[model samples]
Target: MPVAVITGGGAGMGLAVATVLVADGWRVALLDVNSTVGEAAAASLNSNQIKDGSEAQSLFIRTDVTKYDDLRTAFATVADRWGGNIDFVFANAGIAGGTDFYNDSDSEPQQPSLLVEEICLRGVVFTSHLAMHYMRRNKPAPGGVIVSTASAASIYASPELPLYAAAKHGVLGLMRSMSLQLASEGIRVNSILPGAIRTTLHTKTIWDQFPVGDFTPVEEVVSTVLGLVNDPTATGRAMEISAGETFDRKQPDYCNETMQRIMQGKSY
Candidate 1:
């Protein structure tokens, strides 16, 4: 059976993804900071194993992605549990950041919290770096797949949420760079940029503010994720999923001195 490691698997889209993967005959390792929710989610998934008869199981590992050591331990545990091969990784943990730059607050605007940067941007990088180590060893599985949860902010600027946008932009850059760097190793990296999904990430006030039918369902994002996981040719692609439509963002080619030097086989 294929093995998957998903960050932020305790709730929302993470749990939804884990449930689907378990039902589809994949053993999953869920990493979440909230041990209670993580364990409960795993139990819920396992409760259905009798119905699926796939004997699929889930392991919940309490992890704070902002900490590198936590990520290393989670990945190692997954590798050991699954016999040293990880078929897939989903780097999906993130926050919306501190107050938006343009929020309607009476208080003066403050800079984005360092915690937001650490979790949203640095956490994704650390997860991807760890994923490469295991994914490279996943032989006989046509290489391993990595899918990250970016956001629509990755492509378009959000003046209201400047730091959130910046963090997502960082995710895109990491995904694109690693996708090209790891292609030869058969490890494909891609990202999903979903628009306003009705997950725990949104508060009730945020949800109520949205027009009816404006927010994309969590299931829609889950379906897109499944598609990306199964598509062998997908790499370095950022898929934008909105309420009524979905599309891939076009990435530009690099043609700078760095590219020229790399093409000439010059070491950096």
Candidate 2:
């Protein structure tokens, strides 16, 4: 059976992706730091517990993506359980907390601290590295995919959450570079840049602060993720999901022109 591994699988978009994949007949291995939530998520998807029992087989492992050893162990466990073939890996673990640009007097440490870099950027890079290691070892199967959950912040910078924006931009670069590097290996690396998803992580106050009025539903994000998983032709691409809509990453003007010139073997 094809196997998929999802980091940050305990809650939010990660859990939603796991649930959708389980329904689609893919065995899932969930990795997250929150043991309680992770275990509960696994139980929710396990085929054995359901009456119809058609759900995909699932397991949970406590992991901290910031730690390489933890990610290594989690991948090993998944490999052992699923016979060494990882069909898909979703590096979706992330965190969001920072200082408010509008409020300089808001001396709360929760606002724009170093934690954003530690968890969001550094953690994502570590997670992607581990995923790449495992993906490189996997025997090529149809639809072999590696995806990371980035944010719309990658394209449109947000001054209020500068660190978060930088981290997500780094994620986009990671995906693009990995896509080029792994193409010959039959492993496709991509990213899903979600606009605004309603999850425990995003408070109502935050949404109100955003230029966009509300958070997009989790279901909409999950559907876009599933679509990427199902589409073999989508490689080195970033798919954006937001309130009932989905779009591809827009190429920069310079890059597009450069690509056109390169294709025609002529200077722009």
Candidate 3:
């Protein structure tokens, strides 16, 4: 069976993905900052796996993504339990920046703080770096893939949430770069930009703004994630999921002949 690691896998789309993968014979390790919910979520998934007669066992490790030591320990725990090979990684943990700078009062305008950058951007970078280490040493072949949960803010600027937007944009940039750099080693990197899902991050006020039927289902996001993982030809791709719509976001390929030539010249 293939082994997979998922950050923020205790609830929402991450947990949904874990359930699906577990049913399909994937051993999953869920890493979340919330130990209570994380352990319960893993137990629930394991129950389902047992009921379905799957031999796979799911593990839940308490992890704070902002801490590199926590992330390293989580990865090590997964490796020890499931062996060295990690077929897939979902770097999906994130916190919503609740301040809307554009609509704020004159007292103070909210801005992207260090914590926002640390978890949303830096945390993802750390996870990806560690994933590459284990993926290169994967069993069978070196075919490993990483999928990140960027937001719709990644593609379009979120005036109300500039900090969140900027952090998500950083994730997109990181995903694209890793895709290119790891392609030669059979490791694919991709990101998903989801719009307004009714997760815990969405407050009641925010939920009221959208129509009753407009919330994108978590299952849709999970399905897209599975597709990206199984699609061999997919790499450096950004999938956008919103209410009643799903499509790929096209990005420019900057590595033209001119840039290649310039890089070659610099190689001397």
Candidate 4:
């Protein structure tokens, strides 16, 4: 049986991805700090298994991705349980750094600006490093994959969430570098840049601050993720998932032109 490890699999987009993967015949290991919700979500996926008529092997481990030791232990447990190989890894654990814009003087000092950096940027980096360590040791079962949940903020700068944008940009940089490094191992690493997804993480308080109702369904994002996992040729790619639209992350022509002009010392 193929095994998949999903961080932040307790709720929202993480849970959605776990459910879909389990239904498609993969055993799931859910890693998250929220023990209560994580266990519940794992149990829910086990209960929903069909066709196989047997429950999916699901384990919920309490993990803090910001800590390297915690992530090391979590991966060890999964490797031991599944015989030292993982078919896929979803570094989907992330938090939204609320509406702490630079212009907001009334906002508290301990807002999304610093918090997003710790959780999204540092956390993803630590988790992906551990994932790569384990992945390099295992033999690929036809198709080995690593997918992460980046955001549209990676490309577009959002002044309202400067830190969040910066952190996601870091995720892109991580993916780009890892893709080249991991190619020889046949372990594909990619990211899903979801524009907006209707998940619990987007709470009313958060929505009130940003006030954007447009959201792509969780199913759509999950489908895109699955496609990347199934495609052996896809590596170092980012799939953008938005409502009624999708695209691969590609460099724009203007950026290339601007770079050439800069190299030629041309004025704007």
Candidate 5:
């Protein structure tokens, strides 16, 4: 069976992906900060509870992705338990928080919170770094796929959550920068930018505010992720899944022939 590791696997899209993979005979480790949801999710995915002595088809490990030690240990445990080869990694752990930075009403200059970036951007970097290491341990060949959960904010503006938008943009940039290089090592890197989907991240009242076509279905996100994972030729791709449709957002074209030649150092 193929082995996979998923961050934020306790709920939402991560758990959904785990469910699909398990049904298809993939062994998975669910890493999440929430022990209760993580344990329950693992148990539910397994036919028999994976006691320490038994072969674990699905395992849950409490991990705070922002902490390197936590991420490193979680990946190591999965590699050690699953025959030392990791086939896929989903750096899907993220959180949403924003503050009004321009506010002048504060009596004191309060420290701005960067928790969103810490979890979304930094976490993905940490997870993918470890992913490459263990995936290179594959016995016969070194190969794996990595996908990070970016957001619609990655490409467009989210005036409501500027910090979150910036963090997601970093995720997109990180994927694009690494994908081309990792392809040489038999690894594929990609990012999934999802529009609003009703999940545990926020209440229904908040999500409901989106107009009709603005809210996307979680099922679409799942399919987009699996499509990228299975497509051998896909790398350095940004898949935007929203409102039951998929689109590829390629890098913008050069401004002009002269600039293109100058920047690319080659003919247009």
Candidate 6:
């Protein structure tokens, strides 16, 4: 069976993706910070397998993606259990938004919390780093696919959450840079950009503020992710899923001949 690891797979789009992958017979390992939810998700998937008269097809590892040891051990555990190779990885764990930059209530000036960037940006970077290590083991065959969860805020400005925007933007940069290098080694890299999906990411009150027509469905995002996983040539793409449609937001070409030459290293 094909083996996959999905961080943040306990709930939201991550769990949904795991559900689809499990149904399709992929052996999956879910890495999440919540033990209760992660274990339950794995059990639910395993229960489905039992109904199908097959062995359990899912496992959950309690992983704090921000920590190297936690992620490293989790990756190694998955590789050891399923074999030495991993076929796919979804670096999809994220927090809703960063703390308000100007909202501190203490009399003294306080240092800002970077937990938002740590989880959103650094989590993705850490996940992708270990993903490459195990995916490389698959050769004789082409290396596996790596998909990170980037937000639409990755490209657009979000004045209300500037720090969150910055971290997600970093995810976009990482995906593009990794794809340029990894494609030559037969590994595809891509990202999903979802707009206004209702999950635990935000409160119901917050979600209610957006127009119903403006909401993007989680299923739409899942479809885009699976599209990338199944397509051999779909890499370096930041696909935006909004209002039931999918669009590959294209990056611009160099502005002029001189800049193009410099960009492509044809000029100094």
Candidate whose lDDT is highest: 6
**How many backbone clashes can be found in candidate 1?**
0
Model 1 lowest lDDT segment of ten: 97-106
Residue pairs in collision within model 5: none
* Residue 265 lDDT (model 2): 59
Q: Local error of candidate 6 at 108, Å? A: 5.0
Candidate 3 on 86-203: residue-level lDDT in tens? 9999999988857544564667666535676677888899999999999998877787989998989998978777788889999999998789889999999999999989887767
lDDT (Cα, 0-100) at 181 in candidate 1: 85
What is the TM-score (0 to 1) of candidate 3? 0.90
Residue-level lDDT of model 5, residues 1-268, one tens digit each, is 7898999999999999998888777899999999999999999898643334344499999999999999999988988887899999999999885466555664887767778889999999999999989877787899899999999899999998888999999999899878867889999999999988878877777877888688788888888899999999989889998888898999788787897677545664
Candidate 2, 1-268: lDDT as tens digits:
6789898999998989888777767889999999999999998788443234664599999998888789889989998988888888888888876555345553554444566666666777887776777777776643378888889998997887888888889889888877877788777888999887767566778766766555577888887777777887778888887777788985555557778677545775
Using Cα atoms with residue i matched to residue i, what is each candidate's TM-score against the true structure? 0.89, 0.84, 0.90, 0.86, 0.91, 0.93
Of models 1 and 4, which has the larger TM-score? 1
Error of 5 at 188 (Å): 0.2
The all-Cα superposition gives candidate 6 an RMSD in Å to the true structure of: 2.1
Model 1: lDDT of residue 95: 81
lDDT of 1 by residue, 96-209 (tens): 834644556578767645676787899899999999999887766547989999999999988767888888999998998889888888999999999988777867887799
Candidate 6: which stretches are off by over 4 Å? 50-53, 104-108, 257-268
Off by over 4 Å in 1: 50-52, 100-112, 140-142, 253-268
Full-model lDDT for every candidate:
0.87, 0.80, 0.88, 0.82, 0.88, 0.90
RMSD of each: 3.3, 4.3, 2.9, 4.8, 3.4, 2.1
Can you give the lDDT of residue 170 in candidate 1?
95
lDDT for predicted candidate 5 compared with the true structure = 0.88
- Ten-residue segment with the worst summed lDDT in candidate 2? 47-56
The TM-score of candidate 5 is 0.91
